[model samples]
Target: MHYVTSKTLLSSNNGMNLYRGCTHGCIYCDSRSECYNMNHDFEDIEVKQNSAELLKKELLKRPKSMVGTGSMTDPYIPIEKNLKYVRKSLEMIYRYGFGFTCITKSDLVLRDLDLLEKINERSKAVVQMTLTTADDDLCSILEPNVCVTSRRVEVLKTLSEAGIPTVVWLCPILPYINDSHENINGILDFCIESGVHGIICFGMGLTLREGNREYFYKKLDENFPGLREKYVEKFGDSYTVSSPNNRELMKIFKKRTDEKGILNDNDEIFRYLHNFPQDSVQTKLI
Candidate 1:
């Protein structure tokens, strides 16, 4: 890990990434795509040493609080063990009473449960987990080296029981791999059973780009030989890799989410994510 002084920490939308590049090694990671243009290796994490301090400054100046992270890269990367930057940032957010949200695949987030609960008590805290496959074996192949789907479900359940809302990203359902009807239904079942507030699934598919595509194909050749050629023949340098059963799987996804009353539309879920609720006392006065 290397430290760099960031000029600014939060984005216009109030998102912040304390670290760049990930070590979790998800085979289909989009952050590794050339479009992102990281100067360092993907595993050689770049830490924003000033992130927490800058976040404190920014939150102090803001009129309202709605800060989020873990969009471009997972905030709770393995390197966080030595850094503890994410934990410190969460402490700042809780101290300032800012609503917090993050997307991560690691159960390491449980370590900061105290700060998360505090933020949820004062404002709101949303935890979004990405679940691509229900099968542990397939999950190992697809998102190798991260926490398995079952453990992530446990995290979601634990967060839900704490009254901290949760969202699930059921995405990148690799074509011909984990795109079966049973796989989608199994994950959706877990979400509904765990009482997830919403699910963000953009159809049933994955997208491959310059850097990520090469990496994914290399993994395919190593693990699932002959699959790379099939992908090339089917997609042929295309960005989107929709499953052949996309329509059918989406039908099940929409119907099940609709039945459970979980927020299914991406825009609506995003709105829920960004919309900070006014304090109950303020609402009563108004």
Candidate 2:
């Protein structure tokens, strides 16, 4: 990892990424795509050294509070164990009394659970975990380096039990691989059983770009022989690879989450995440 002082930390949308690359090595990682124009190798994380300071400075000026992280890169990467940048930033957000949300696939996030609970108490703190496959072996092939689905489900259970709102990203259900009825239903069962507040699934498909497309196809050939040929034959150069069973499996995902009272629609979930409740704002006003 290399350090650089960033000109700004927060985006116009109130989201911030402390690092510009990830080491979790998810085969379908959109962050690795060329369009982002990350000048460094995806694994050689670009650390925004001034992130905590910049965040604190920016939060002091904001009239309202709602900050999110880990959209482009996993904030809880292994390097966070030594650097604790995300933890320090969280402390700043908590001290400033701003709501916080992070999407990650690492159990390393649990290290800051105490701070997260405090933030939730003061305002709101939502943790989003991505679950793509229920089968552990398949998960290893899909995500490669991060924690498996079962352990992530356990993390969700732990967070839910701690009174921290949790959301699940049931996405990138790779076609010809984990995009099956059983896989989708299995992950949904975990979400229901774990008591997640919401699930964000943008169709049962994965998007591929220049860098990520090559990596994913290589992995497909290595892990599931002949699958790459099938993808080439079907998708060619298309970006979105929707599963053949997308309609049926999506029906299952919607029906299960609706029955369980978990927010299922992507738009509704985004609104819930970004729109701070009037009650919380009123209390802040007081």
Listed in order, each prediction's TM-score against the native is 0.96, 0.96
Q: How close is candidate 2 to the true structure, as a TM-score?
A: 0.96
Candidate 1 residue lDDT tens string, 199-278: 99988888889999999999999989999999999899999988999999999999999998999999999998988878
lDDT of model 2 at position 100: 86
Model 2 segments more than 4 A misplaced: 281-286
lDDT of 2 by residue, 1-286 (tens): 8999899999888899988888888888887889988898889989999887888778878856678995899999999999999999888877777788999999998999999998888788899999999899988878878899999999999999999999999988888788888898899889989999999999989999898999888878788899899999999999898999999998998898888899988898888788654455323321
Clashing pairs in 2: none
Q: Which 10-residue window of candidate 2 scores lowest in summed lDDT?
A: 277-286
Cα distance off (Å), candidate 1, residue 250: 0.4
Off by over 4 Å in 1: 280-286
Give per-model CA RMSD. 2.8, 2.0
lDDT of each: 0.88, 0.87
Give the CA lDDT, 0 to 100, for residue 55 in model 2. Answer: 87
Candidate 2 local accuracy as lDDT? Answer: 0.87
